[model samples]
Target: MDQGTSKGVSRTDSVDNGEGTVSKALQGSRKKKRDKVSAYERAKKVYEEIQEEKRKERRLRKQEREQRQIATEKYEKTKRKANKMFRKRSKKGQPNLGAQVEILLEKIQQKMK
Candidate 1:
């Protein structure tokens, strides 16, 4: 085979050319020269972000629990007041059961509001 020309092969298509070897060597050096400190900083930043998200979630759950407790207390207070009023009215000899029920319902609705 002649150095200038080959039967079906071109000079650019040959991997044995020197350019390919030089480029591969440069790429290897570039990878080895990367900063280790930057990688550590990136990992630390990711960890902090995850911790912040967890804190937000915990705060939201606590607020929901507090709201539930408040609602329960309010409901219990309303129930006790209604029961006391019903007993007082009964002891007074109010004979109409339907009127007493209506009064109890109205009191409950007013307390809820």
Candidate 2:
């Protein structure tokens, strides 16, 4: 006799209508899904930031290591050149050659330390 009288609710006022019930349920579900997406986005952003920081640190350490290696090589080359010069000068006297060699070795050790 009355289609709007389901469970004694009325269709004249939309508050008592099935449309409001269905819309409310959909809004609640959408809110939950949106919260989940927001949480995931925040976590992803933090992970990316941490990775970038680590990359920067690695690059800096690599640069420092290269610099130290270059310095060590230069010191070694200078020590070898000094020894070669001392050997050539040794034709004059052996005592002078020993003293010069010792000085060159000490200089090299200082740089290495």
Candidate 3:
């Protein structure tokens, strides 16, 4: 209401909240601080959620590694068996068992890819 001043800066502390005290400005500043704290809290919660997801992903990776190790062991055992069987006797026109090992190796390579 004081159009008589330069740059519209009020010196009377009556620019807001009709009480004509500095408390209104203080309250506004406090509300801004509270909003900033709340925003920080929301960001912290999001960080915690991302950490939890990383933990879950690590657990799944460990489980998958164990499963792969077991499968590889089984495949190697089967390979050894076939090699031994093929070495001992050759039945006419039967497919080469070594070829099965090659196929299994190719499948393992494809899985890695």
lDDT for each candidate structure: 0.74, 0.75, 0.76
Q: Can you tell me which runs of candidate 1 are displaced by over 4 Å?
A: 1-37, 89-102, 105-113
Q: Which candidate leads the pack in TM-score?
A: 1
- Any runs in candidate 3 off by more than 4 Å, and if so which? 1-37, 89-113
Model 2, poorest ten-residue lDDT window?
A: 13-22
Candidate 2 per-residue C-alpha lDDT over 1-113 given as tens digits, one digit per residue, 9 for 90 to 100: 77758877554433423445445456667679877757678999999999999999999999999999999999899788777766664566654667676777877898999
Candidates sorted on lDDT, descending: 3, 2, 1
Report the lDDT tens digits of candidate 1 across residue range 8-110: 6565544344455345456566668774458779899999999999999999999999999999999999688766655653566876576568777897888
Each prediction's RMSD to truth: 8.3, 8.5, 8.2
* Candidate 1 worst ten-residue window by lDDT: 13-22
Deviation (Å) of 77 in candidate 1:
0.8
**Colliding residue pairs in candidate 1:** none
Which residues of candidate 2, in runs, are more than 4 Å off? 1-37, 89-113
TM of each candidate vs. truth: 0.50, 0.49, 0.45
